[model samples]
Target: MTKERIEKILKAGANVVLTTKGIDDMALKYFVEAGAIAVRRVRKEDMRHIAKATGATMVSTFADMEGEETYDSSFLGH
Candidate 1:
């Protein structure tokens, strides 16, 4: 897997990221290093509820998270 894509996935500001398919060992290590929690095998329906409850927008790709380096605050639910 490309580190660039992995970096993008890792950089999402959410406190926790839920994925239908589990992440790999490398990703797990990166997540630990970044202090982010990644929950795998999340039910699609549950993911919907989580986004709604946490006021987070569900994004399919990390490319949309722009202008993060200029700001320190995490818009993602904490």
Candidate 2:
């Protein structure tokens, strides 16, 4: 929920962020500021379809999410 983290995520050149929950105001602002689209509340089936179509990696964990001291670049969907 940190801007710096969100900024880092967008900086990885993601086309969009597909989530299982609706996006909130803070996240929307961050995505807009970083020039990325945020697609929220996507169904798992659709997420799979999009992943197959785009060849983007899906991250199941924030253990490696952006901007944490333990952040790992591989968590990014690019």
Candidate 3:
């Protein structure tokens, strides 16, 4: 992801991020700088399991975060 995208996620209060895609080195660095954990290349099934276990909603993009049906920082798991 781009630096600005990562910044918005952090600013929205996510401390742990899980994704089924690769995370760029710069984005990883940004996560470290913010004291957050970013785990990439996770399997989709595993992601589903995590979400079910944590009561966290999965969203694909920053734009998807817009509305009640979508997710905000409050939808994130601890």
Candidate 4:
């Protein structure tokens, strides 16, 4: 995933589910700085916990998810 995609998920009020091998702390930190509640490193087995913690559903996809979603600018601490 790209920085834009990470921001998109945060804007949607959803936590990001990053693959273990692909867990980028810097990216996750950026999301949190952008007002994300949390970023979770997930394995297939950890999906349940991720869902429970974030209260957001999970999706499995191979397509590149690297874009920004709309969000309220006011929520960005501006």
Candidate number with greatest lDDT: 3
Off by over 4 Å in 2: 65-78
Give the TM-scores of the predictions, in the order they appear. 0.67, 0.73, 0.83, 0.49
Highest TM-score model number: 3
**RMSD to truth, every model:** 4.4, 3.4, 3.2, 6.9
Model 2 per-residue lDDT at 74: 56
RMSD of 2: 3.4
Error of 1 at 52 (Å): 0.4
Q: Model 3 off-target regions past 4 Å?
A: 64-71
Ranking by TM-score: 3, 2, 1, 4
Which parts of model 1 have CA positions greater than 4 angstroms off? 9-12, 63-75
Q: What digit string (tens of lDDT, one per residue) describes model 2 on residues 17-66?
A: 88777778898888887778888889988988887787666766555345
lDDT of 3 by residue, 1-78 (tens): 878778778878888899999998988999999999999999999999999998887877666534433235876875
Better of 1 and 3 by lDDT: 3
Local error of candidate 1 at residue 27 (angstroms): 0.4
1-78 per-residue lDDT for model 4 (tens digits): 668767665665554344545646787677678755444555666865755565544454424446534443222221
| TM-score (C-alpha) between model 4 and the true structure | 0.49
Compute the lDDT of residue 54 as modeled in candidate 3.
88
Residue 69: error of model 1 in Å? 15
lDDT minimum window of 10 residues, candidate 4? 69-78
